[model samples]
Target: MSAQETVALVLAQAPVPPQDPGGQGEDFGKSSPLGLVLLIVFAIAVVFLIRSMTKHLKKLPVVFDEEKANAAAPAHVKRAEAEAAKRAEDSEATETPEPEETSSKPSQAKTD
Candidate 1:
């Protein structure tokens, strides 16, 4: 058989799909209320995640190199570092060394 005749026979034998009468299938291609609720929940989650990411990003230093960051430190950062250094110095200066105890008893030599 020729290709054209074979194709024609196959087309003739194909079953036709049933169509909705009077377009009564309104539910077709329509999302359910649950789907709408899920979409809203996902949007809210995305917004919260973005806010959290922004907060975390703000906590990060502008530069990872300490020398470079200090060289180009902004006024606020410089003030914060100064306060931290002062606090450390005060803590170290306020720490007291414990006094060592001396025993009054004399040591005796052991003979084997």
Candidate 2:
């Protein structure tokens, strides 16, 4: 109802951060072989994940593009091939002309 009450309510509603020393927080009494084994397995998994990531990262270029980096190529070879094909088709279309009217039908028709 009052500013002081509202401030107190907001302060109470706000979540408090953990004041613990950021330790495991739980006192599992002591360690066990299963926990150690699980930890070692997870550690091995993390190492493998890091190695795999490094391998793939080394294969990738500094400036990578998914659409252009297909099959790890620098440029789009398919696009270049398509452009070459299109140019060849255009040149073929322009290089050849229609057949001429070799017959004397036009001259005969004119004379008639």
Candidate 3:
């Protein structure tokens, strides 16, 4: 009923058993080699899946044309071709060296 009486009653109760200091069960990580092998396999599969998806994404069409698939080039193929053509044009424009105009004779100054 009173705070002092409640405190005395709680203190009079027997304490619970002290638990083992060594908390870990002996077979913790050593439980299953099969689980580790499965985890490794899963990780490898995920890596392969990610790599395949990235490769597929890299080969994707930048532009779409349904008829192109029936023609000489597919949509993705045509997009790659267009990009190649653009790069070629840019390289050609930038790569060509401009010729310097040169006169064979130096101009002589006429003294009056």
* Best of the candidates, TM-score: 1
Candidate 1 Cα RMSD after full superposition onto the native fold (Å): 16.2
RMSD of 2: 16.9
TM-score of candidate 2 relative to the true fold: 0.36
Off by over 4 Å in 3: 1-7, 11-14, 18-23, 29-31, 62-112
User: Residues 5-106, candidate 1, lDDT per residue (tens digit)?
Assistant: 999999899687668755659776788999999999999999999999999999888769978768878999899989999999999999999987587888
Candidate 1 is scored at a TM of 0.42
RMSD of each: 16.2, 16.9, 18.9
- Relative to the true structure, candidate 3 reaches a TM of 0.37
Task: For each candidate in the order shown, give its overall lDDT on alpha carbons.
Answer: 0.90, 0.83, 0.84
lDDT of 3 by residue, 1-112 (tens): 9999999999999988556545656664474888889999999999999999999999877777766655856679778888999999999989967797598888899999
For model 3, the local distance difference test gives 0.84
C-alpha TM-scores of all predictions? 0.42, 0.36, 0.37
Clashing pairs in 3: none
lDDT score of residue 1 within candidate 1: 100
Error of 1 at 45 (Å): 0.5
Which of the two, 2 or 3, has more lDDT?
Answer: 3
